[model samples]
Target: MSATGTYNKLVPEPTPHSAPYWEGLNRRKLLLQKCRGCGRIRHYPQPMCPSCHSMEVEWVEASGRGVIHSWTITHHAFHPGVREDLPYTLATVDLEEGVRMLAQLRGVPDDKLRIGLPVRVEFETVKDGLTLPYLVPGEPA
Candidate 1:
């Protein structure tokens, strides 16, 4: 949590459905839920398909690459623990796989953040069972 200069106040509480995602992050891989019924991908994993209302679902590995669709520079921490790490960037990334994810942005200055900025995922091991995915500026192809 502190490794990237961000506060480690919040740790994800993975549910049964979200366990795969957290587990994948531990291995430095990004995993997203894919609805078999509609061939749609989604984050914040859920039990049924949103597009088709089907119960058939599967897990797929994400490329971990995305473009910043939107972003916000937080000047104050809603959580007290992160108060020291003020002015951090949080972004909504549109993944290459067609789903959007909210993750913290690292290695990118506040002034440089913009829509359509390419980003790639990186993992930080916060604890034994917790590994957080962060966004770093993606390299040019």
Candidate 2:
């Protein structure tokens, strides 16, 4: 959110387990942690798998394709940093890799919003060395 080192928006702080995910986003790729023990993919990276309680983990590139499971339009800003971007859409997307991710939904009008609509991830560089993913209407290529 800060382009000149004065932005006030909160940014993600990567930890040891989540560093790869942040790094992948910087490279414009969406990555998820896959459990080696059970092959279940997960978001919000962690050291252990929730399904199998496995410590074995691997990073895999996600397809970046998903469907809108649900969404809500924010009519008010919860923080001062996002006040200017009022009336934004927050969507819950079910990725093809079997993980659900929540992110800002953009490039679509409110009247056009619907459940089960196709979407894809796109990166936006808010500042140097920092990029984030958001969803937009589209089908996987």
Candidate 3:
């Protein structure tokens, strides 16, 4: 937390299956796992396709758009890392690509937070050369 509600450091490790996804983030490009077998895009970058359990997974570029599926305004810090970022937002965005992502929302006041609000993805570089995606509501996402 650099006096900004950007991101906090987690134990950093990128496995082989998830490396490409991280690489795309380094390039400021959003990527998700697209199952080659069933042709469905998914998140969390699993080793096997969720729907079909096939090992054929490919990286697909996201439109970088989504809507607020759900969210919560936090006031407590379970860890020292998030104490400074109190009253921040943690939201689940339902992406247009059919995958959902959990992230913090920025540039919007807390009172304006609502369900099903349109949001668009933007990456913020926190630390360790890691740029994490964030969302802000506007214009149908």
TM-scores, all models, native as reference:
0.89, 0.92, 0.87
Name the top TM-score candidate.
2
* Candidate 3 overall lDDT versus native: 0.82
lDDT tens per residue, model 2, 1-141: 445766667878889999999999899999999999999888879898888999899999998999999999998878888887788999999999988999999999999888889999999888888888999898744
Clashes per candidate (backbone, < 3 Å): 0, 0, 0
How would you encode candidate 1's per-residue C-alpha lDDT over 1-141 as one tens digit per residue?
445554458777889888998899988889999888988888789988877998777889998888999998889879987787687889999989988999889899888888888999988887666788889999753
lDDT of 3 by residue, 1-141 (tens): 452554555645889999998889888899999999999888888888767889998898998888888888889887777787787899998888988998889877877878788888888777766777877776863
Q: Candidate 2 — which pairs collide?
A: none
Clash count in backbone of candidate 2: 0
Report the alpha-carbon TM-score of model 2 versus the true structure: 0.92
How would you order the candidates by TM-score, starting with the best? 2, 1, 3
